[model samples]
Target: MEQKIFDCAIIGGGLAGLTLAIQLADSGCTVILFEKESYPFHKVCGEYISMESYSFLERIGIPLSSMHIPMITEVLVSSVNGNSLTRKLDMGGFGIRRYTLDAAMAKLAVQKGVTLLEQTKVTDIKREGDLFQIKTAQGNFSSKLACGAFGKSSVLERPLGRLTAKSAGEKNYVGVKYHVKTDLPDNRIELHNFNDGYCGISKVDGDVYCLCYLTGSENLSRSGNSIKTMERNILMQNPFLQRYFTHSHFLYDEPLTISQVTFKRKSQVANGILILGDAAGSIAPLCGNGMSLAMHASFIAAPLILDFLKGRLTHQELCMIYEKQWKEHFSKRIKTGERIQHLFGKNILTNAAIGTLKLFPKLADALISMTHGKPF
Candidate 1:
């Protein structure tokens, strides 16, 4: 038997990895993508994407226009105290279930000749001379270049030296998600804040809605580690959330949950491997633009990876340029999201902020524009 090397090997099959794999395959590169989970799976996400990514997804073969997805052009924000406001959105987005979108992208990637390994876990990756030694559950493989799209938390973080002892114990955030049938407007997205957490609900494809939230881990501890208790005591305090909880029809037996989600800065280049998406730097979910950020990182990386494989750019140049570009585009956005998250989820401050923004609509527009970017 002969061992063959591919042009690129991507470790995760999220939006970043799938999009990058398809782009590289379209350019005639032998690309391999690994996804531990099978296709058409659910992720703990807001499932709302900014318009900045609409054209990009369309260009990449996602049939958003034909999917008849919900278009959101207005926002309804409520404080923990139930002080609420509704305002028009300047750069609205569309909603689609992650499984539907991800599965569509995976199909396109396969059609473009990308070898997608579903249910294949990558145990380790090492650099051997000029090639990357990729050891997975299936077998050992080699590639000219490797990518890390492993989302927010992964064992690979330690091996890549991206996690440290002190940071490991640092307080982490938890995310919860559900699909439901609600009477909320299909053209509007609502965000309701609670102590140490906030929830966002919007219309997705078909008649279902995506209801997702993020909170500090300590909140769960304070509630006896019970999601139902936390939701009833904390989240229901907001009249808006209470209405939805009492009236909506939940479609799942148990909500999808993920923990150890941190928004701290991450290395763009680690162990000589390129990092993209949430694994690189996750924006606060309040920003409602994380999907776009992840896809944009893939958009930024495809060409650079292509250049390196073609020998047009040296490895040092590729790493340096990618880091610079990644920071230039996303650093400020993440910082802004952090600041916004800080101001929300606190009763007094969030109520005052929402009250003020309601009186001054332009101020709300400016705040939104800060966390989002112009179309790529």
Candidate 2:
């Protein structure tokens, strides 16, 4: 019997991969997704998504309207020394845990006719002739095309030599996340800044609030390479963070953490594999629109992928157009995020900047606008 070949094989089952699989399957294409972890797992993410993707997610069958997700409309930003500013959010967002959202999207993908393979890791991908050979832990498979949605850091990325980099001598970061029971308004998101780091807190599904932070790797090293030491000595120095840490009921004994998190730009098309989400280009987490950005990449790639599968365009054309569109949509947003992140982290500088932005609310709104996008 001849081997079955899918239209596309997706590696990684996060938002990008799962959403892409659903989109392709909805359009009558065959897709098989490979994920090393099972559904409903936790990830080190802030868990806030810009409203720009609400309608798109619904259009793709996420049922966000029925989920009763928290709608955040205000932002409270504090400086390293606890100087603070509050502003009404113009392009507000909502908070949803990756544990809930990714699992929901995974089920939606399977319902949409995409083959969902959980606990299956893709060991390598090689393009030979016109098809992609996907070697996985469960078994090998072939597809007309492949996508890399294995966000942030992945062992599979090293062989492609796309955006893989050595962490040594690089300015990397540590991301720490927790789901806590805290006293915070569901309609507001708070960002508390400390030396070399910032923490974001907002409500998610049910009564849970997502408390997540990002700090320089050097901060951990300076604290004896201990996450607890770093949080107590560095993060707690901020008055807002200290209060939350002291008062909140932490749901986990140990926080979820990811190290060597770098925001370097990556190629969208590499070695015939289309890259999506943080695997393509990671905006600084300070922007708070990463989930939307990742979903938008799928929105852009879906139709073009269908175009390629239906022989409306050549493979080379698909790669070129997707790269161009990805850059056009996201390059400015990512650059703005990087620039704004630089404005944070320092005590005196952030103090002055927040004071000035507070004095001029329109300027603050404009800065936020640059980091976000319109509803798709």
lDDT of 1 by residue, 1-376 (tens): 8888899999999998898898899999999999999998999999999899999999988889999999999999999989888888899999999989999999999999999999998888888888999888789999999999989888798778877665664558889999999898899999999998999999999779999999998988899999999899888998989998889999998999998787778899998899999999989999999889989999999999889988999988999999999999999999999899888888999989998998898999899889878898
TM-score of each: 0.98, 0.98
TM-score of candidate 2 relative to the true fold: 0.98
**TM-score for candidate 1:** 0.98
Candidate 1 at 239: error in angstroms? 0.6
Give the Å error, residue 34, model 2.
Answer: 0.6
State the C-alpha lDDT per candidate: 0.91, 0.91
Model 2 / residue 146 / CA error / Å: 0.7
- How much is the lDDT of residue 104 in candidate 2? 95
- Model 1, total clashes: 0
Q: RMSD in angstroms, all models?
A: 1.1, 1.2
Q: Which residue pairs clash within candidate 1?
A: none
Worst 10 residues of 1 by lDDT: 162-171
lDDT of 2 by residue, 237-356 (tens): 999999999999999999999998888778899898999998998888988998888999999999999999999999999999999999999999999999998877878888999999
